[model samples]
Each structure stands twice: as structure tokens, then as C-alpha cells.
Target: MHFSLPDIENMDHRFKVNFINSLSGFKSANLVGSIDKNDQHNLAIISSVFHLGADPALMGFINRPDSVERHTLSNIIETGFFTLNNVTQSMYKQAHQTSARYAKTESEFDETGLIPIFSNTIAAPYVEQSTVRIGLELVEQSQIKYNNTHLVIGKIVEVIVQDNVIQNDGYIDIEQLNTVAVSGLDNYHTTHRLERLAYAKSGVQPKPLII
Candidate 1:
């Protein structure tokens, strides 16, 4: 199954989108929470959230084109703060529902029956049902010239997770939290840890390093 540039470009729009999206493999599933000046809450499910840097604790996510009304993107721009809440096995249905287009005044929390939690550190709301919650402050945003999409980068200001999930080596066991992954546009998947390996070195095969 191979496709050239012309073949891909000529494919059906929906088929092309699904094919291209799935080619990237599993992506991190997160519920992006934001609020407008009026305190109107907005929630959205995004799969593109990715780590940018560790020193600054930076993260980034892609916002689809703003040709349509994008409440979550607008609210984040308005407030300069947002949250990335991990979608777990129990809450993925509600998390995916947040992707639906709703009126700016309508709160996805209310619409989807998901509880919203708040913190003193940032104004954005977090998913109370999520086991891993991260509050971030918007640091930079730029439009991708090729696709007209926007890349939103944020600095991690706060992380809410159970202490037991953190390993002694600074690794958080997301599998213990039942965090789910996304594939294509709507498929949700649970992952299994194959094995943790020691750092690779030249002329040396890595060995299992499970704690």
C-alpha cells in the first residue's frame, strides 16, 4: 500500500484526513480546557499535544484553522492560560465529545457532564476526572504557513498527579493512570508497556531497566 503525492492529493477528503492522521501512529490524547473573560468555559479534545523542551517545561499543540469559530483557541488566547488533562479509559467518551462544535457560551463541561476543577495557580479549569492534569501558561503562538494551522506553545506551570505514579527515576507511569491514546480522528486505544530498557550506548545492547 503505497501512495505518491499526487495519489494522496487526489484521495477523498475524509479518507485522506484519516489516512494521514493515522500515519503518525498513536498520539497523546488530552482535553484542552480554557475560559473566556466572562468565565465561560470551553473544552476541546486534541491529539497533537507534544513536548517541546524539558528545561523550560514547554509543550505545544496544533489548533486547527480558525476559519470557523474555535472557542477553545479563542479562550486560550484571551486568557493566556490553559490545561492539558489526560483522557483516561473511564473518561474518553466524554473527552471526545468535547470536540463537537458548540456555541461560545455553552460550556462543554456542562454539555458532556464532565466535572471542572480549578486551581489557585491558573484561571483555566481542569478535568476533575483526569488522573493527570497540567496547567500551562501560553508562551508563544505561530501560524503554520503550509496549512494555515496554528501552533500553540505553553509553559508548564503546574502538574497534578498522584505521587505514587511518579517513579524514583523521574518517570511518570501513565499506564498506571489508565491514560489512553488516540489514533486517526476518533479511535481510542489503551497501551501496554513492553519493557523499559537501559540507555543505549555505542557497541552495547540496552538491557531491561524496569524498576
Candidate 2:
């Protein structure tokens, strides 16, 4: 179970990738949708999405090394708009299919069995099947010197959620919508609400909220 850097470095490439990805535990599964200048749509499944800040509603995700051409990344850079759509049980199979290398002229939404839905103001498209969707405007991008990977960040400009899942305080009930999770590359999972707890204080023992 204990693996030093040398041991990890010596492991098989596929095994090492799976091990490292799984080590991050469960990650959010989303389909990033973007459109090129020609209006060709692209969708790619990514689990690296993370929240960066709330004031500007910023979020970021790690793009893999840029050795290969990434259509989704390129389109986002070109148009400055992309969407993060929650992958549900029904759409995960199609979502995973999007990872396959498709030609730049082809749309993953067309290759897979998914449909692309558009909004009035945003240039990018969203997955119509997703229960929770977010539109973001590109703000910052940083290149990781060590790996040649890029850290893509954006500010949330739009949101779409199933009305029944929205809470009074603004939390979305993901469990109710059956939003899926990704473990490593191929393994998918379902999650449940263990409990939402109140903020911990010095003297007040942390307790679960009864909501």
C-alpha cells in the first residue's frame, strides 16, 4: 500500500494513472460543453472541476497535458464560454463516450446520444439531459510548468437547475437529482447525503443539521 515516489514512477503507466486518479477520492463529474467559431459543438467529460471562490463565483479545472489537441479547451479559449453540466445515471454512458478522440469538425453531442441545449446570451451549449447546469466565462488560465498541463479558471455567469432540487438557502439537492460521481477514469458511482452539519465552533460540538 505504501508507495514511494520511485515505486510510483516505476509502476506501469496505465496502473499509475488509475492509482493517482483514484487517490483523489470521489470527484465531481461534469460534461464541459464548448463551441468553436464554426459553430461546431464539443463536449468532454471532466472530473477535475473545483470551486475556487464564491464572491465572483469562480471555478477551475485541470486540463490534461497539451501535447494533444483538446477541442473543448480550444473552443473555450476561442469563445470564452463553456458549460459544466452534471452527469446523471442516464447520461454517463454517453458522457464517457465523449472522451474518445473525435475529429475537430465533429460534435460529440452528435457522436454520442446526448443533445445540446443553448441559451440566449451564452455562446456555449449545455447538455439538455443534465439536471444541473452552469455557464462560465473564461477569466484566467495558468500553465503548470512541471507537467505542461493547464489550470483553466472561469467565473460563473449563468446557472440552470431542476426547480425541485433548489433549497431555500441556495444549496442544490444533488442526491435528489441523482447526480453521478467519478472515481478514476472509468468507474462511476452514486452518492447519498450522509448529513449536512452546522459550522464547527470551539465549544459547540459539531452536530448534524436535521433539515
Candidate 3:
């Protein structure tokens, strides 16, 4: 369960990929949207949704160096508005296809046959088929020199979720939505909620504490 940097460097490419994939099981699928100055729109379907627990409803994702089309970054800089769409099992393939490096003039929504729904609060478009769509405003962006990756932080302005998928306890049921998670490069998986745990500070003593 332990791997040193040297050990990772010594491993084969496939092994390194699998090792990193295992380490990144905590991520979630999120579709990021932005509109260029010329009005061209772009989206990057990402599997990295980290820093979601911070106050002020913050979320972030990493954009790889080679994957830079710059439209999304430019739009965020200009308008400070973007949207995050949570992909479901039914839209998995289409969502994945949006990762293709298409021309700036091309809209991934049009290319993937996904419907673009106008956001009531934000100007950016969101995937209509997604069970959860969030309108976000860009708060900050930082570029990492090590990997040439750009880390974008956004504040959730508005949240839209299907009524049926939300539980009475404020939990969104992934199984109900048939939401899929990504593994490695091409692997997709359906997520199932196994159990719910009480908050650490709830102080509710359980007859049998089990994780």
C-alpha cells in the first residue's frame, strides 16, 4: 500500500497508470464550460472535482498542459462565469467525447448530440441531460509549473438537481441518477452508495459503530 517516488519511477507505464488511478479514486465527473470573447463556447469533461468542501461552496479542477485550448480559461478570465454539469450513465459516452480537442468554433454540445440548456442565473450553457448542473463563478486560477497544469477555482452560484434523486436527508442518490465514475483513461463505472455515516460532531452514539 506504500509507494515511494523511486518505486513509482521504476514501475512500468501501465503499472504507473494503474497506481495513479487507484490513488485518484476520490475524484468525480464534472463538465466545465466557458465562452470565448468571440462567443465560441467550449467544454472540458473532467473527472477531477476536488476542494469541494471549502466554505463559500468552492470547487476546482486541473487542466492539463497539452489539453489547453485556452478558450475556457480566457472566458473565465473575461466573464468569470462557467458551469459544471454532472454526467450520468446515459450520457457517459457523449460526455467523454467532449474531451476531444475540437476547433474553438465547434461546440461540444452540438458535436455530442447533447442539448444545451440556458442557465437562469449564468450566461454559460449546461448539459440538459445531466442530473445535476451547477452554475459557477470563477474566483481564482493558478498555474502549476511542475506539470504546466492550470488549477481553476470557482464558487457555486446556483445548483440544479433532479427532484427524484435527492433524499430527505439532503443526500443525492448516485444509484438513482445512474451516475458514472471514471477510472484511468477509458474505464467508466457506475457508482453505488454503500452506507451513510453520521457527522463527526453529531455525537450520536450508535449501538454498533461500523464503517
Candidate 1 C-alpha lDDT tens digits along 1-211:
8889999999999999899999998999999999999999888899999999999899999998752227878888999999999999998999988877888878999999999999999999999999999999999999999988999999999999999989999999999999999999899999999999988889987899866
Any runs in candidate 3 off by more than 4 Å, and if so which?
1-4, 10-19, 68-70, 201-211
What TM-score quantifies how close candidate 3 is to the native fold?
Answer: 0.84
Instruction: Give each model a TM-score.
Output: 0.96, 0.96, 0.84
> Deviation in angstroms for 175 in model 2?
1.2
lDDT of 3 by residue, 145-207 (tens): 887889988998998987887777666776787777887766788866656765555566644
**What are the lDDT figures for the candidates, one per model?**
0.92, 0.89, 0.79
lDDT of 2 at 157: 96
Candidate 1 lDDT score at position 199: 83
List where candidate 2 sits over 4 angstroms from the true fold.
66-69
lDDT of 1: 0.92
Which model is ahead, 2 or 3, in terms of TM-score?
2
For 1-211, candidate 2 gives per-residue lDDT tens digits of: 7899899999999999898989889999999999999999889999899999999899999889642238878888999999999999988999999988888888889999899999997999999999999999999998999888899999999999878878887788997898999998899999877889987899899998755
Candidate 2 least-lDDT 10 residues: 65-74
TM-score of 1: 0.96
